[model samples]
Target: MTKPENTGYDYDVVISGASLAGSAAATLLARRGVRVALLERHSAPETYKVLCTHSLQACAYPVLDELGLVADIEKSGAVHNQARWYTRWGWIEPRAAPTGPALPFGYNIRRSTLDPLIRSRAAETPGVDLLLGHQVTGLIEEGGRAVGVTASTPRGERRIRARLVVGADGKDSAVAKFAKVPVRESENTRFAYLAHFRNLPLPGGMSHTWFLEPDMAYAFVNDDGVTVVAVLPDKRRLPAFREDLEGSFLEFVRALPEAPPIDSAERTTKIIGTVNYPLLSREPTAPGVALIGDAALTGDPLWGVGCGWALETAKWLAEAVAPAAAGRGDLDRALELYARRHRRRLRGHQLLAADFAKARPFNPMEQLVFAAAARDAAMARHMYRFASRLIGPRRFLNPAALARAAAVNIRYHRIASRTARRPHKVA
Candidate 1:
């Protein structure tokens, strides 16, 4: 609970969280000569949330590359490539389709290994005063504008004043709550159970996911001799899952058509579960405060989009607010621009994510696409690009794409109908 000395308040921006988005913003802004105070409640640099499956998609690769951490991340146990999605119909293998470039793949790396690296990088940046173990209990307002934070630690309470306060806290952000920001809650109720295992034999260096009707499961293979596995189920089933997490998690994974390798692998970490309550802020910015990462918007984890979105938001906000924080433009104006840009860039994806989180079984069209992708290499590749988030959902669901998918579906159904007529062999 140790806190930095109260050396009086002076910083261009005071970031209230020290995880992914906050650290990224702190690093970028501080490197640009903007004085930053990066605060976190956790004292241990190695401490990280173990609930996430820790999969970063291709959409985030460019952001990491810009931060100059892509190489370092790759070296620190990142497994590259897209995933093989096992549908009830068939396995959708990776292939090239007619959507944009060959989908650039990304990696899977545990946060236990990734968060500390990024936090350390932020601490090393020249203009950032990294303050760990300090919990911001309240905000200091001046003329209706948030100008500083009042934090408490073992040393005592202290006020660190700054022109701007950034809330990079994760979903369920205390900063957002304290600021009384309006939040729009989605009714989609899903929960996730995650764990890590060693010696799981998976296909390629790729991650894998199973869209098993009402239940969704994922497996992420990292380079550190382990794979992360997770089960996401509708909230209605949460009671049974909570009764026996480890047993229920294993049972769920084993029930998938293409069962995960967890049964064969040795469990390396204790199972963790989190109730999924996807949320997004109605306003990402107020007078002198702004939110980023999950604090701004927490979409469903089914898409594995959280980490990428966090990095993307940090980069976007950094670029948008740099001139303002440096006194070249109005800070409020810059924050408004950041908010608009975030909505424009991610609204469509968020809508899609919320719709998918309902846990409803995939419709006929979805089944057709999965079945076709399993049989056609070209189709699989196109599907890969969409699944990797290279293309927006609109483009992926275009009329032409649907028509092609329909043709494939007809072929598969016809074959199945004929086979059913002659199916008399006992297994």
Candidate 2:
């Protein structure tokens, strides 16, 4: 396509896919005085993604707080939860210790409430116009750069022109497809399933997980007296679950030590699940276009990193491009800045998550850290930091840190052996 002489744009930016990432980006960009057109294929305002467990990671709390949505989210009855992992050794639950601070907590509200709340906020923002039932069809290229999008709407089709086009869509992003973004794919060796239940209370309102090596189970607490029981077992066990999903899920959860009251709790939702989900990562930026959230990276769902990354990435994208979007600076430079930030922040975490998503036993390094964590509070905090994405993977994998964990684990085991050999006093 030949270069078209400069034409007027309806908005500064056109964002396709108005889910968490799309809507959040629209709000942030608009708040910075950049006009935005947010598009969503779903017409109903209340529609939410059912396939998700919808747990936000602690790393994202600051973003919510920054957006001034924390109070309203709490008012919506979202539960605050910290994670505890149950290994064969014991629960690697972190507490306040001399070596570090306490683990931060995150929110667990269903998507039904979260999606609409964020979308509504974007719609109400001064410079954002939320367009519903508008699915992206293609991009308008000028001088070999995307300058706008053509979307299929209820009436027919509309060409929305803008200086920049941002794709906040999902893993199967049409925006990315039209833009010809390069993709890096990884395989998922395990499948995931989840169901909601009532009358399922947890201690301290915290979430719990059992890491049974190749397979895993969880009882994640959510809002409105709901608990989301989920499992990510190896593909080898898929047949048993497929035969009887309810029975298999219940039996798996009940078999864990100190399990929730699944027998007494009433199942509220159907067995929502996904199999054959490949881990996906994409080049986040191109000429005149950018991608955020799942459109850029889709890690394994078991870790629940999607929601947190969505809000945080949107924050970064908006900050980097606000001046450009408002016509104050060069937009090309802004896209490059956002791309660098995205790769620097999330690339390592995404790779590590993909590696572990494969069905396999815990390697020696994993066992060493987990064993030490269960026996030592400081190690537990370190592991939690890594798992929470508060610290980078290198911090957890350094030779010095691994050696320290080994020392801690050996000391605890030696002391336990000595105590076991000692005769108990007669009572």
Candidate 3:
């Protein structure tokens, strides 16, 4: 970390990175009239996250609505739909809404549009100083407490002090590194590849995911008749992907039980990809500083929770620290509160996501529950509650739910067996 000459304080909160999480924090904080310094490495407003499919889960609707972004996002032509999980047993889709009165539909928009839209919103908010082309280089610590950040911008090295510093940077966070925070990463056993296409046929404009056990694929409809097709194959298939990225991806998608129209669609963007996108969880805060978004926790990208979690964490942090920034409470206590809330809300979800990131086959219980979900509407709602992350694992897999799932599977099997045993009509 580079040390820079002392510079006078600029804002109450200095946030590193101007991606989804950082922008969201800046937006909310600025709205509350908290002085904020939002720094981004990139200079251009149009710059967007290249690797993301930008699927915002239904649970994030409230946060978006609170931020006043829902109307703009809808105007941008975002696709509204429910997620349909294609399992070996059957397709598990809830016919009714997932028991939410507010914006019941999840959204899929291209990151190229979404990121800039969010950044623009944040920049327009009063009390936010959006500084671009600033790359974080070090933390400014005073008496064991982080007071500010050092950055190298196009002009020169600069130092900006603050009451509190926020690490909204992505997984490889410079702020986290400077704070000496410990991060535990779960090994990612799968490699993912995706591309954007036009005129891709997505029935009902619904997001579809095929759980091929050890290999997975999906087709997500987005704005303006564009669709994103992605495939996640186990690491063992690396050589094949390397040999022919496009061919391998198309082959995998085409081989799905219910294939998408990738072969016929016009490929609009170059196929983008990533390897070993593991689940990472880091300490959310240290004295005088705090972390949000991927800086705090990053689960597998396969579940499409990155963008949603980024927005959610930003909202959480802003809510926690707003009163403190307004001089009504202790900043340290606010950070502690944020930490506890982060753990309570995301710990279980992260653990499950990390386990699923291993690319292993589903266990017996998962099979039973998924099969039951396909056969029974009540069971499907319960499954969606968990899938949409409205409920925790304990509630999702409670004794009663498990027993109901088991009963449904048993009845389904019995009916299938009876039909098989009956003599076929001769014609």
Q: For each candidate, what is the lDDT?
A: 0.81, 0.88, 0.86
Q: TM-scores, in order shown?
A: 0.89, 0.95, 0.95
Clashes per model (N, Cα, C within 3 A): 3, 0, 0
lDDT tens digits, residues 1-427, model 1?
A: 1132344447878998898899999988876767789999888887786777587788778878877898899788688857788887678888555564665877788888889888998888888888988889989998888888988866989788887899998888888878889888876667888888999877675778888777788888886888888888988889898888878888888877757657779998888777856656457888889899899888787778888888888888888897777556899999999999988878888887777778888777677777788877767877887777677767777887878887887887898899989969898
Candidate 3 regions with alpha-carbon error over 4 angstroms: 1-8, 97-103
Stretches > 4 Å off in candidate 1: 1-9, 96-102, 364-372, 410-427
Q: How would you encode candidate 2's per-residue C-alpha lDDT over 1-427 as one tens digit per residue?
A: 1122255887889999888899999999988988899999989988788888679888888888877799999999998767789998899988777665656867999999899998998888888888999999999999999989999999999998999999998999988999999889999999999999998887777889888988988888888888899889999999998999889888888888888888998899898898788999999998889999999999898888899899889999999999998788999999999999999999999888888888888888989988989988888888887877777788988898899899998898899899999999999
How close to the true structure is residue 129 of candidate 2, measured as C-alpha lDDT? 88
**What TM-score number comes out for model 1?**
0.89
Which consecutive 10 residues in model 2 have the weakest lDDT in total? 1-10
Candidate 2: C-alpha lDDT = 0.88
